[model samples]
Target: MNIADVDTPAVLIDLDRVEANLKRTQDYADAHGVRLRPHIKTHKLPRFAKRQIELGAIGITVQKLGEAEVMADAGIADIFLPYNILGASKLARLQALNERVTIRVTADSAETVAGLSEAFAGAEKPLEVLVECDTGMGRCGVQSPQAAVELAKVIAGSPGLSFAGLMTYPAAGKYAEAARWLAEGKRLLEEAGLPAKIISNGGTPDLWHAHEAEVATEHRPGTYIYMDRYQVEKGVATLDDCALTVIATVVSRPTETRAVIDAGSKALTSDTLGLTGFGHVLGYPGAVITSLSEEHGTIDLSASDKKPKIGEKLRIVPNHCCVVSNLFDVVNLTQGEAVVETVPVAARGRVD
Candidate 1:
């Protein structure tokens, strides 16, 4: 089917651009001797995950068990579940998944560590655990390198848990500091007779700066597959590198300065994240997405001389691609203006 024939408010992935982005990111990681584990949370489609792995990604990083399961079930052998695993049921599932593939998870607490170790005691292979350091993200990791070392020591001594390495999600611009902290943690661990082999750090904003830091041996960049408004706003990627967009039909032109499209909060998401609005229009450079409802996206098109007529299609690049992807069960794959195929967002809404 032609792209124009497809339904409005549909997510489209440009095949050529996506392949180029995958190659660029993968080549950069290979050149620097750092393993690239492109996070599948951004795209969620198994076909894209296979493409990334074929492009030289060491493995894939998943935020939750469901994402991991989707990838694993699709024949992805090496998987990393970066989030801390808790609860008896989740641990049991992780242990079961370990029997089929190489599964690794993060930990920041002794109680959680003990729980995982106890749960996976009889597994065929030890559950690989990485000490999660906060590194200024202030989110889910432990605060200090000393604390990370302590956790590593505990994991080393645990029966079913093995200290795989140190992991972190560094805050933007904190790459150098995070690298230092991770390096320190590794040194302390080695000195204490516990060696850390995998020092993993993840963040799309800090991808370029990953090599500058010494200890980061692997990177987990999810959003690079579909560069969005946030990455463009932060200058992480240029407009040319953006591969995904919401194709919306201009359904309303009530005023001379504003036009409304059929994509909105449910389509683009409400993640401004210091940006001006929900998304940005490609051809209409200066126009801003002023307002968004569940089924409508309002754009201020007064600055441009050309106006979108009723039924005209326009592509809207979302601010946060990850969240926007989760809202849809499938996305249309296209080449230029031609529709290639429709791929399901296999891991969408798989929060578990």
Candidate 2:
């Protein structure tokens, strides 16, 4: 079908751009001898996950158990869950997921380790657990290298768990510091007679710097699959590199410099990412998505002399693409203005 025939406030994925992004990232990783186990949170589609593997990704990463289950059922054999699984119900689900795929998990606290042990104590095969380190991001990881070693020991001694390695989500522009921290953790682990099998760190913000951390064996990049406004602003990707764009129709031309689009928080999402506006309106460089109501997006066209007429269609690159992916049940795949296909976002509401 022609792109013009599609409805407004629609999610569009450029098939050519998606294919290029996948191959570019995988090629970069392969050249550096770094494994690409892409995080599935961005696309959340089994087809893209399989494509990543076909392009040489060792495995895939999922933030939630629901996502892992979806990918596992889709025949993705190797998966990584970088978050700590606590509650008994979640642990049971994780165990069930592990039964079908070769899955690894991460833990930052002894409490999480204990829970993992209790759940997998009598299992046939032990679960591989990685020690999550703070490494300057100051998120969900151990504070120091010593703490990482101690946690590794706890994981190794657990009945149904094995120490996999170290993992961290480093601060955006601080790759060197994070690398030193991981290096220390690696040294400590080796000295303690528990050498790490995998030292991993990831963030799309500092993707090109992955090689700086020589201690890392693999890298996880999620947003690279669908470049967004945030990625473009960070200079990590160019506007042409983005594969996802929301096609919204102009619904109002209120005054001289003001216009409204059909896309709003419900469709375009309300993620600013510290940017001055909500999203970038393609073909309207002067337009700024000033504000968004539940069903309306206010655009300030004051920067440009021209004004969009009511009912005019516009393509928008959202501030954050990952969140936008979940806002829609399905996304349209297009090849140069032709709507080739539409696929369900398999892991959209998989928040568990």
The numbered model that scores best in TM-score is: 2
Prediction 1 TM-score vs. true: 0.98
CA lDDT, every prediction? 0.89, 0.92
Cα lDDT of model 2 by residue, 1-352, tens digit: 9788789889999999999999988888888887888999999999999999999999999999999999998999999999999999999998998788899999999999999999999988789999999888778999999999999999999999999999999887778999999999999999999999998888788788788889998899999999999999999999999999999999998898999999999988888988889998988888899999988999998897778899888999999999999999999999998999989999999989
lDDT (Cα, 0-100) at 151 in candidate 1: 88
Q: Report the lDDT tens digits of candidate 1 across residue range 9-87.
A: 8999989989988888888888888788889889998888898999888889999998888899999999999877989
Runs of candidate 1 exceeding 4 Å displacement: none
Q: lDDT winner among the candidates?
A: 2
